[model samples]
Target: MFPGTEAQEETLMMELSRLVQEQVQGSSWWELRGKDCAILGLAFVALAPGFLLLRSSSLLLFSLGLLLLGVSHAAITVKGAHLSSHSSLTRSPLLNRIWAVFFIEVCGAFSADAGVQAHIKMHHAHTNVLGLGDSSTWKVPGLSRSLYLFIAPLAVPVITPLVALAQLKHQPLLSSLRTLLMVSLGLWSHFWILVHVSEFGSTLSALGCMFVTRNFFSLPYIHVNIFQHIGLSMFSPEQRPKRIYQMSHGVLNLPRNLLLDWTFGHSLISCHIEHHLFPKLSDNMCLKVKPIVSRFLALKSLPYQQDSYLSRLRLFFDQYQELMVLAPPITELVGIQ
Candidate 1:
């Protein structure tokens, strides 16, 4: 239960929890595991062809292959790395940690441990808190809007690995070394495949391909990261309310989108309120209980923020200076005191 929630809101929370539990009870463990594994397997399958096609002499085929690989890489990062970091992909903590290291650190080219600290421990724990989880991952203060939108996103793939390396300074020596080794091996293995298996004429060309493919969808990725939270209310640490209230007011769900939904999962895209309410629930489970949660919130007269992606884009462009350039002000909810 959230601290300081009123009796009526508490009751609504209890009812919502019951409905979610009932929905989850009908799901099978195998089905959950199967879906996650299938997605990861598909990502690998997508990347495999890129290696094969890279060997072709045709530049068009090479570019097409790189695009496919890039999209698959982004999908794995979103659906696999993000879920595993939250321990929502599996019930076992060990398995979740393993997946995080593999998917986030290795394939996604970022630190798994840092992701847990930043995303799960910080972001989820303090959603929309000023200086905290207001989806500040892609912030580029003082940059021109055009450059911020176009050039900055393309740098994410390069910046990710560097950020991982920087994070090592704050970690224990042995653990840091281990992560360093794994990250190096992961990056080297991919490059080796490009050179040997893909038969890229030169290492420079292979490196260029890596940069292009890994960051192909970066613009949308960054947009989605900011779209859900930036324009919403931001609260100070002391002013933070109960989970349901904070999330409903702060998180905005985008309309149904095939690419965003498939890559980012239902919670980040469509069923955000349900997700913020039940952080432990899997993405599939979030989608399942979305209707129940939505109805319950509607009945309780709570905010269930939803917006179209295009509309958000327009709002962002119109208010870029106020929303992105400057820090957002804290929102004081009426009757909260």
Candidate 2:
């Protein structure tokens, strides 16, 4: 349904399918397992030091430790919860569901079911479709551009749990109760650890530490969420094209930075096109198959969208009026006959 002929579209789809098949055939399960374990280990490593230093008398040390903890939280949400929600963390469905409940619902402080519904079922299925897949972060109707850009993003950490709680009402009764229990237990466990193990001495300080650490990376997290799918073409359900065409036009990959790549995983900051093409592929596998996908797109003369992080930031700043302050108009492209 893109601008290409039916035969051309079929050829591209076939090539993409072949690339995915080849990648899957060559991949080792052990390698994926190891990578997942290592990243999960790193999340704990980032948090442990913060717990130990939470009661530090020195302000600077406490702030540094909190920053580390925040980075760990960000990494878990972006890398662990996101992947688990997609059922791409491992090959086992049971393990993926368990992982999603643990990382996404408990630690990430969001409902796993809601995440799967909104992210996988909706966002992935209908990328950049107006009122469907456009997960715009700055939708505050009367807010000024400067405040929307600066202040709104800082509220994400607080907003996450609240939104999760609200979304639970729409889920099935069993799932709603499970998410509620997990969130309650997760919050209580963190508080207990902070007060007793971390020796924070008082509940207020413990809560403060939790808040600071969890929200430290909120700005960047929100930025990355918006930058990828927003500021691009948006389609209606009827106007939407095939998967390959929709993703290539709607998604933009930010240039890879070592820190972001490690925290957010390769699928998000880089190799995003490959991830969109193969949503169920693990982040590491997406990186591995990036060259093949890129080359294939190039050969077919299809768009492979990529932009620098700074450039994207600048675009958001410069075009805040057009892109964020006002709702982006639905993109209408001619469908092939």
Candidate 3:
């Protein structure tokens, strides 16, 4: 676990000094293009294999197809949609929104409306607050911790959009209408292929497997999400500071993990501090900036939290009780404070 601290005014100067040194002296257009292409390239790779797998008539082939579909979808959800929504993967509003639909709705079978609501609105704003932030989704006031971890991820995806819809119906007319249209379209497309597309085959087992595969992806997707933010420092609304402080304080950047970081980009776990600090920076840019960010934190004698994937995974499960059930004692609130 990382230690939290308060920075003196002079300390802030040192942190920023390292941040400047770490940046790619100057940004360029190609750097941005390269990242956008990488994101699209990965998307196509994930999607093409699934299409090929689905075309096969054999059950074994189809099962493999479903696995591919789930893995690709997970990558989009974590790597593509999550980062794009934050505008951390690209700059174009049009491109980010398009990726948003492809990832949140089409691939992940989740609504962009709810994802924004939970992630950008609630989670980013409140962070680890008791009931306001999306972190609360993992909490089970009275239930056993093990059961909560198992069920929370499975339940959130199904219920989050509905919660978003209900919350927005009377709020913004335009936003509400757009959300409804997007959600309806997304659900329609998913069911249409599963139920009516004859080529995909219509069978109880096939349909069951589709759902089962979707559910299976949820575990890791949720694990990464929770592991990145839940067990970290948090602060109340009243204690929150400037946007930069709020972002840089609580968030920690774990070391790059091979498969997970590649799929989810540096923003998922690695360079996470930079992502929170500068949401507009592309994933590649975040990776480029990590050394600067780490040095800044380190010079200030702060822990830029990082751990091996296995170690973090173990910590999550081991501390599930305190993180989700009992809640950590408010020792040193970081970002929001």
Candidate 4:
């Protein structure tokens, strides 16, 4: 039972959301299925050069290739694969999971099972709940604004997986085992390729360099996932209304940067409001649905949180002192009120 008879208000909001969705004929901004294909196709193109670069090239060329490969994987994993795997990118179950494996294991170099558990279960279920739903482990309390930004890139590959795996400690043994296997395979793939490259020269040195570069460039991908949701609202399950509010209020959409948007899909920024509303929407479809979502929220007198990229970057910097620092909310003094 919702208090204050806001039940009527909630109903009206839902109605408006439905009407706008109907206006768009239930399609999102673009061809949903087509975008998936385009994203995957481009990823494969990048992968080919990556494989060749590993086998035959100077260390400099090899490092650049690895860097590009990391970029490509981040784009495909976050944009192309994540939405589809969530079934937000498409309707086909078989195809969606297939892409999930390719992107999750091959490109993302992690476990699909782990990714799903951390992303869909914990993050979605208890977002920003301090130690519980915290996805921003890189944040340290009382650190200078500059320090957080500087060390953030180095923490991604090393820290994120450990945190994600910890979140899965309660999972069934079978599920956990499966995820670990996938993780191992992802690790082996990188090591194997690097070792093969080393056969041509100082393999040990090459391995060290590859490890450093591979993890370092992974920052952007890691940053997008955390910054999108962690700093936003953290509502109690009791007060939760519709999914729309959870997403719109709980998540902040970063400004549209063409290069980032094209690489990471709307999940990195756009479809989030729609995702919180309808988690099933694909990236391609989410854009189509954005107008509908915005109108619906507007009619209901709701706030749709969107900030410019630079603004968000600044916010992340400014709030560095409070980030990852457990603290209580502030209440106004008697006179101030």
lDDT of 3 by residue, 48-155 (tens): 566567767899987787777666655666777777678655567888788787667666655576677778888777765556763666556686655655676676
Candidate 1 positional error at 206, Å: 0.4
TM-scores for all predictions = 0.94, 0.93, 0.79, 0.78
Which one wins on lDDT?
1
In model 4, how large is the Cα lDDT of residue 251?
Answer: 74
Clashes of each: 0, 0, 1, 7
Off by over 4 Å in 4: 1-6, 20-30, 54-64, 126-145, 160-169, 195-200, 328-337
Alpha-carbon lDDT of model 3: 0.64
| Candidate models: Cα lDDT each | 0.81, 0.80, 0.64, 0.62
Candidate 2 residue-wise lDDT, 1-337, digit = tens: 3477667777788978897788789778855556755886788887888777766889898777777787788788778887888788777899999999999878978899888888898888888887788885347767776777678777776788899899988999999999999988888888999988789878888887777777776777778878888898888766767677888888988887887887788888888788888888877888888888888888877789999878888898898888876778877657642
CA lDDT of 284 in candidate 2? 81
Clashing pairs in 3: 240-336
Choose 1 or 4, whichever is better by TM-score.
1
The RMSD (Cα, Å) of candidate 1 is: 2.3
lDDT of 1 by residue, 1-337 (tens): 2234466556767888988898788888855555756776787888888788877779899777877787788778878887788788778899988988988877877778888888888888999997877777677887988788767889988998999999999999987987888788878988888888888779898898788878878888888888888889899988776667887788888887787777777778897777788877777777878888888878877778899988988888888898898989888775542
Candidate 4 residue pairs in clash (backbone atoms < 3 Å): 28-288, 29-287, 29-288, 88-280, 88-281, 88-282, 89-282
Instruction: Candidate 1: list runs displaced more than 4 Å.
Output: 1-5
Worst 10 residues of 2 by lDDT: 30-39
